[model samples]
Structure formats: structure tokens, C-alpha cells
Target chain A: MNTMEAMLASLPDQYRWAADLTSPSLRAATGALVCGMGGSGIAGDVAGDVAAGAPVFVRKGYGIPGWAERLRPLVVAVSYSGNTEETLSGVEAADRAGLAIAAVSSGGALSRLARDHGWPLVEVPGGLQPRAAFGYLTGAVMRILESAGLVGETGLVEAATVTDELLGADLDGPGRRLADDLAEGLAGRITLIVASGSAAAAAYRWKTQINENAKSPAFTTTIPETDHNEIVGWSTLGSAIRRTVGVVALRDTHEPPRVAARFEPTLGRLSEGASLVGEVWAQGEHPLARIASLCVIGDMVSLRLARNAAVDPVPVEAIEVLKRELGET
Target chain B: MNTMEAMLASLPDQYRWAADLTSPSLRAATGALVCGMGGSGIAGDVAGDVAAGAPVFVRKGYGIPGWAERLRPLVVAVSYSGNTEETLSGVEAADRAGLAIAAVSSGGALSRLARDHGWPLVEVPGGLQPRAAFGYLTGAVMRILESAGLVGETGLVEAATVTDELLGADLDGPGRRLADDLAEGLAGRITLIVASGSAAAAAYRWKTQINENAKSPAFTTTIPETDHNEIVGWSTLGSAIRRTVGVVALRDTHEPPRVAARFEPTLGRLSEGASLVGEVWAQGEHPLARIASLCVIGDMVSLRLARNAAVDPVPVEAIEVLKRELGET
Candidate 1:
């Protein structure tokens, strides 16, 4: 199997590890900041979404908000390879601020820093692209929150079971069918993913995955919010949108009726401006399962799109070039 | 002056009013959720950015998070015309939960509901489109917070003076000159606005204004964060970006050294793909002044682009039609 496929198959293992794991006592902190970058940061977004009853903020840049000091946040530094420069800077800043810290990574600079500082560190079974290993990173963050008593236990194990069922179902199943259908509509157009509630974070995941894996332009924004601003950008694009843009609405049971009501009006407004409008409904009993299922569907669509374009999805050559160039300078 | 121009000129008035306002004794509230829609909603974004000592959450849609009841946030409902249906739904939900509430609007259904419940209400100055009245809505929300003691005194009055200085300067001035330059290059291309720190909120404002006024496709995202994701989309587009996309990066001296470091690297990654990459610096010493300056610059750019496109900047036919359609159904 390819790396992405293998990493996805190992998701159940990550959930199993998280379910049995014990955590050290965290300090008296009212909130938590899950510090990461790129894929690691996206996982933090998912963790924050499912981290019930806790104020979880995802920090992606070196600049932490001023409120962090006053909240005395439990800082969760997450870097899959343990080498993300931004996360390391954040760890140091959090330490200087005297905030409690937790670290998650494979053995690398972050692990060394955590060891040096005696912070709680969880090691992932490494050797996958950071985005591909999102399940483990996300599960580790959520597990740490649960064990630390900051959040209630998540239905991660159940979610993993649903994922397994999805894997077995293949082309005729919900996940693959949804992927093939969306890839057809979104093949050559800029996709705008609209979503709300817990699924909002997952909407962003879909956008980034399309950009990286499908090699296309995509955008995502939460609703009721998008209703106010971006919906107007549609009219401004005029006729060009008919050929260049498509809409993907991510829906879940949790969307309030009033928010749902806005969708029909949005469709009327976007009718001629968009090439197509599509929907993806998250299917699961728990919010965690729903979120994971939606993410997996999007990942598959991105893969399907890559297949359509006859491009190898694994090679992120431009990113590699940027990294090499950045290192030299 | 037209409503938008009057409101823009009266930016000083809003600040002056906010500086003098005294808030009623709000209940012991720790954090706040500022609920708003469209133009009214962007105000909440600004309030959250500068509400130094407190965490402000901006809820755009009806599906408030499940944790909201547990958080018991001091809910601030903002809708400039006081008639936004979604904001009213949110207000009702917040009230049902027995959360403390504050309402800001110009006599509409929301004002009536706020009065009936004995909750705090701030009346916006009447007679303007909700978007045009953003300055008044923004100031009222900030003033409400100050009055409630949720946040400390903002240098609002001082910031107004800077607006006066900007208004007095001619075409050779900071706002107009920057606008002319940007509109020149961004005349017929899709603009992607990139920003970080306090300037991030302003970036969204710029994007929306361009969409609504200039009638174009535009996007905004914060930095370091954007570096991790959207930068990949640049290369993925291959050469299409060279013909279709222009990037506008909003800069502020307040950005950290590490974040500032990424700009050069971003330009390098974008060099081959983008038609043009431009940077506009925040103009004043205070954070508020700097943010407002960037916004004014963007507002002017949108106007200039509208003139170039031979489109009237005021009418929003699609939005009006959508509102009428939603009301009927």
C-alpha cells in the first residue's frame, strides 16, 4: 500500500493506544493551547473541536496571543517529526511564561526539548508524512486532554471502528462513492467548502487536502459567517464563476434550522455563478465519528482527483524545493 | 454624503461616543461571545482582536457550540439594522440558556427583544445599509464591553484623531496613494490577501470590501498559518496563477521577527505563479490606528477598482434579492 493508505489503515491502532494511555498530572490551567504547524496544526484544530468542556486554542505561528499568560494555558506542543521550527519557538515561549507543557512527536528536536525540560511527551510511531499520520497526532492530543481531566472522553475507538467499516466498503460504499461523485463535479474548478458546528474544522481539512493532494485551488469557511461576507464575492465574480467555481456544502445533524435555512437562499444566489453545488453529510452516532468520516471522504476525493489528473499525489516537490531553499538561506 | 461615506467620515464620532459611554453593571461574566451577521459581524472580529484582557468568541451562525452553555459566555448580539434573522435566533437561544445578553442595533426586532427581556441594549444611529454602518456598530460593541467592564479603556478617542489626519491628506496621502497603486495592478485579477497579527482582521475586511465594491473574487488568511497550507496551492496551480492571481500582503511593524522572515520566502514561492505581489504597511503607532489605516487603504482600493471596472460600488443586487427570497420562504 502507499504511505497515505497505510497510515490511514493504522488509524485504529492510534485510537487503541490513546484509549489505554495514562497521563501525568497537568498544572492548574483554565485553558489549553495546542501548538503546532501545517498538518500538526490541522490535527490541533480537530482536537479542539472534539475537546468538550475545555477552552482549546490552536496556535500555528510563533506569535501567541496575549491572553495565554493570564489563562495559564496547558501548552500542548505537537510536531509529528518533532522538528517544526514554529512549534519549538512556541514551546520555549510557553516555558518562559511558566505555562505547563505537554509534547507529542516522533524522536526529534521537540522530543529532545521535552526531555531536557521534563515535560510530558508522547511519541508517535513515525515514518509517515505528517498529514498522512493525522489520525495518530489528533488522537494523541485528544487523549492527553482526556487524561489531564480538561475534556471528557472522546468516542475515538468507536470512530476508528466506523473508519474500518468504511475501508472495507470500497467503490460502492458511502466514502468511495462520495469521493468519486465530488471529484467529478470539482475536477477543474475552485472548490469552496461551507460548513459549521464541530464539522467546521473538518471543512478546512478538506480544503487543504485538495490543495496538496489534488493539486487544485480550494477555499473553506464556516457558515452564518460566510453568509455575511464571502457570499457577495460570488456575484462579483459574475459569469467567470460558472466555469471556474464549484460549491461543496458539508452538513451534519447539529446544524441549527436557521443556519440550514440560509442554504437555499445561498443556492439561489449562487445558481448561475457556480458550475455545481454539492453536499457531504457526516454519518456517525458520535461527533468524533462524523468528523473523521467526513475527513476520510474528502481525503479520498482528493486522491480521486489526483487520479483524474494523472498526477502522483505523493510528491510535494514544490514544498521540498521551498524547504531546501529556506535551509540554504 | 452617502451612507457609506457619512459612516466612514463619522468614524471619529463612533470613537468619541465609545470613549464617553458608561456600561451598565453586567453579571460576573468571564468571557464573551459576540454574535453578529455580515457587516455587523466583522465588528465582532475587531472587538475580539483588541479585547486585550478577555477572550472574545464571534458566533456567525445559529449552531452555537455545545460547550457554550458551560462557558456561560456574556453574549453580545450585533446586527446593524436590528433585523437580521439569524442573530435574533442566536439571541433567543442565548436567552433561553439564561446567559447574560447585550444587544447593539438600530431599532429592529432585536432591539425590541432586548428591551422586553431587560437585557442591555445599545442603539445604532439610524438610516444606512448594515455594511455601511459598520463603524457605528463596531464602536457600540466596543463601548458596551468597556461599560460592562469586560475590557479596559481602549485608546478609541486617540485613534479617531489619526482618522482625521488620514481624511485631511489628499491623493498623495497614505490611504489614496496606496489604493491607486494596488487597484492598478489588481484591476482584473483575483486578489489573495495575506496577513498576520492584528492586521489579520483588517485583511478580511479588505477582501470583503473588494468583493462587494470592486465586484471581484478575493481571499484573506493569516500568515505562518497560510505558509503551511495555501502556499502549496500556489505551485499546484502551475502557470494559471500567473494570469489569474495577484497577492496583497498587509504588513505591520508589530509582526514578530520570525513571521517577518516568512514574507521573503513566500514571495520566492509565489514569484513564478503570481502576476503581482504587493505589501501595504499599517500606518500608525497604536494598534487601533494601524488597523483602521489599513482598512481605509483597502476601502479606497476597492473604490478605485470599481471605477476601473465601470461598476457602481453601492448597489448589492444579489444580496438584496437573496434577502427578499429568504423572507418570502
Candidate 2:
């Protein structure tokens, strides 16, 4: 298997190991404000879908939201490399607000900050691309929350089992089937992922993975909201433009009935002018497992698209150049 | 002038009337949760950028966020037509949470609900499309917050003056100039907007405007964050695909210095493969005015694109169809 494929295959092992890791100082809080960006940050989004009792909010910027201070939510700062500037800035902001803070990283500035400040830190394995290390990062995050009493242990254990079962299915099973369908449908087309409720986060993950792995432009719009504005745009699409678009609906069983009802008609409207339209249903009972199932397929599809286009999925040269220039600036 | 053009030009007058309107029942709260969808919901985002003291959180979903109950924020339900289902659901959620609630709409079910519940309602004039009434909606939202003591009266008053000054400049000035640039650069190419800090909301406004008014796909990515993953996508873009992408940077003076420094390198990287790369700086000193100026140009540009493409800027048939089908369901 290729590097991304191997990484995908290794997720169960990563999760198994990382799920057992926790920080000693971690404890329950009123709510959670997760701070990180890109691959490291996406776990916070996935965690929000499964986080029980306490509300979880993801911050993908330099600092926490203004309301976060008043909420006094536990600030969970996550950076896979432990050195992301934006995540560092966010942790500092949490410190200033006197909010409880935790850190999750391999061993970088974030870990150092955690040590210096005596904040709880959960360190995961390093040496993988941030995106490739998603399982480990998410595993560590869920463990932290579980340790804090925010997420119940039973639910997480069930989710981990479900995730393992889904990933361990036959080699040519659902994940491959969805990836095959996507590879054929999304070739040379910009992807438009329509999802709502918990699946919205997965749709965003699909968009970003397609962008980073396939090196293609993909956009996501949640339902009900998309029904209001973006649906209108489809009305005037020219055939040529439509031919360059591929629409995917990411569906979840947990969405409210009202949200679920709008998908069929919305998809019908979108399909009339697009190159292709397809649906991918979440697998497993647990929210985390279902979101994970959806994301794994997208990850596979992105890599397939990369292989099809003869592009390397590993090196993000533009990001490297940007970081280099940013260091100078 | 076209319908959208007339609406764009009349923003100053709309703001004048809306700024003076207030509801006496509104009072200060720990934070503000603004809920609505599409055009009406956008005001909440703009309000977030300018709101002082208390933080403003915009919800465009079916109900309030998971954390809103604990925040005990004042729920500002805004629906231009007063009948938006999502906004109604959100208000109900707010009521159940026993949080303070306020309403902004022209007239519809929302107004009736507000009257029945004795919730404070700031009623703006109806008739125009929701997007066209952005000034009225934003003004009402700002006024509601000001009256609630979440936002200061002086700052809002200053914002209004600055908005008027910026919008009242030379007829063929900055707004028109930027529109011309966008019309030239973005025509036929899918637009990609890059913005950060307070300007991110305006960038979203631009994306939705381009989608609905221009009937084209437009995507937005925030800075510092975009530098992480999205920048890499630009590296491997083939020339053919590159030619179909137009990149615009929506800039604000208020973005943190760290964020500001990354823009040049990011844009330089994006410019290498994009059809065209350009910058549109937000005008005026106040956050509200600056965001408004950026939005007005984008509004003008979307209309100009529609005129160029021989498409109508009004009447969203697809949205109407979805709503009708949803009702039948």
C-alpha cells in the first residue's frame, strides 16, 4: 500500500494506543473550546459530534471566541506538531482569560508550554503528516475529554469498537466502493459536498482532504442553509460549468427529521445541472464511528484522485513555501 | 440601474432608518446569540465583528448551538421575512433555555410569535429581497445590541457616520473601482476569496452574494489558517485548472499583525497559478463601516457579473421550489 493507504490502514492501531493516553491534571469542566487548525484542528470538529454532556466548540483561528471567556470552557489546545503558531496564540489567549487549558501534541512548543504552565498535556506519536495522524490526534482528544468526565467511557469504548469493525471490514468493502464511485464521478470536477447536522463536519473534512490530497478545489454547504441561498445558484448554472461540478451528499442517521426531509429535493435540484450526484451514508451506530466511517471513505477517495492525477499526496510544497516565507515576514 | 444596484445604492438610507429603531424590552446580557439563515443570518456575522463588550455568536442552523443554554446569552432572532423556519426553531430553543430573546423582521410568523410571547421585536420595512435589505437587518441587529447594553451607543453612532461617509463618496469611486476589477478578473472564472479576522464575515458575504446574485460558485478561506493546508493545493494546480480560478484577498486593517504578515506570501503563492490575483481593502475606521464597505463592493460586483452573464439578480427559483416541496413533504 502507498503511504496514505498505509496510514489509513494503521488507524485502528493508532487509536488503540492513543486512546489509553491521558493527562494527569485533566478534569471535568463546564464546556470545551477546542483550539487548533487544519488537520490537527479537524479532530475537534469530529469530537464535537460525539462529546456528551458538555458542549464543544472548535476554534480554528489565532485566539478563542470572545464568548469563550465568559463561558469559561476548558480550552483544549491541539497541534499535532506542537508548534503551530495559531494554536500557540490561542493557548496564550486562554491563559489571559484564566480559563482552564489542556494541550495535545507530540513534542513541540505546545508541549513545552504545557510543561512550563503546568497544564495537562497528552502527547501523541509524531513523524506523520498532520492529516495522516488524524486517528492518533482524535484518539488523544477523546481520551482527554473522557478523562475530564465530559465524554463517558462506555460511549468512547463502543465507538472505538465500531470504528475498528468498520475499518477492518473486507478490503473491497464500503470504503473502497465509495472511493471508487467518487474517483469516477469527481474526476476533473470541483466537488460540492452537501451535508448537515453532525455530518457537516465530515463534509468539511471531505472538502479539505480533497483540496490537500487531490489538489483540487472542493466546497461544502450545510443543508437547510444551503436550501436558502446556494440552491438558487444552481438554477442558473450553464451546462459547461455544471459539467465541471460534482455533488456529494453526506448523510447521517442522527440528523433531525426536519433536516433529513430537505435532502432529497435539494439533491434533485442540484443534480439537474451537475456532472454527477451521489450519496454516502454513515456507517455504525455511534456518532464518532459514523463520522469516522464517512471521513475514511473521503480520505481514500482523495488519495485515489491524487494517484489518478499523478500527484504526490505526501509533500505539501506550497504549505512549506508559505511557512518559510512567513518565518521571514 | 438594476434592481440589485438600486438596493446597493439605497443602503445609506436603509441604515439611517434602521439605526434609529430600538426595542425597550431588550437588556444587557453576558453574550449575544444571533440566529437566522441566509440573508437575515448574515447580519449576525457582521454584528459579531463590530459588537463591543459582549461577544456575538451567529447561528445559521435549525436551533441554537449546544453551548448557548449555559452562556445564557440574549438570543437575537433575525429573519427578514419573519417566517424563516430555522430562525423560528432557534427562537423556540432560546425560549426553552430561558434565555433572553429578541426578534428582528419585517412581518411574518416570527413577528407573530414575538408578539404572542411578548418578546421584544424590532420591525424593519419589508418588500425588498432579504439580501437587498442587509443594511436594515444589520442596523436593526446593531440597534438591538446597543439597546441591550451589549454594544455602546457611541461606537454604533460612529459606525453609522463612517458608513455614510464611505458609501457617499464619489459615484464612480472605490466601490465601483473594485467592482470593475472583480468584473474583469472574476468573469467566467470561479472566484476564491481569502480573508481573515473581522473581514472573514465579509468574505463569506461575498461568497454567498456571488453564489446567489452572480449565479457562480465562490469559495472563501480565512488567513493564517489557509496558510496551513489550502496553500498546498495551489502548488500542483495544472495550468488549465488554474486559468479557471480567480483569487481575491479581502483585507481589513484590524486583523492581528501576525495574520497580516502572512497575506503577502500566501497571495504570491496563490497568484502563481490563479487566473488573476487582486486585493480589496476594507474602508472606514470602524469595524462595521469597514465590513460594510467590503460587502457593498462585493454586492455591486455580483450584480455586475449577473448583468454580464445575462442572468437575473432577483428571484431565487430553486429556493422557492425547495420550500414548496418541503411544505408538501
Clashing pairs in 1: B23-B147
Assess each model's interface with DockQ, reporting 2 decimals per model.
0.51, 0.59
Q: Residues B84-189, candidate 1, lDDT per residue (tens digit)?
A: 8778878888888888899998898889988898888888778776766656777788777776666776657766776666655333345666678899998777
Give the lDDT of residue B163 in candidate 2.
50
How well is each residue in A258-327 modelled by candidate 2, as lDDT tens digits? 8999989888877766655588888777778788878887888888889888887887778877777778
Candidate 1's C-alpha runs over 4 A off are A20-30, A169-174, A320-329, B1-7, B20-29, B169-173
Tell me, by lDDT, which candidate is best.
2
The C-alpha RMSD in Å for every predicted model, in order, reads 2.9, 2.3
Write model 1 residue lDDT over A88-183, tens digit each, in one string.
888888899888899999879999988898998888888887887777788888777876776775778877877766655333345777788889
TM-score between candidate 2 and the true structure? 0.95
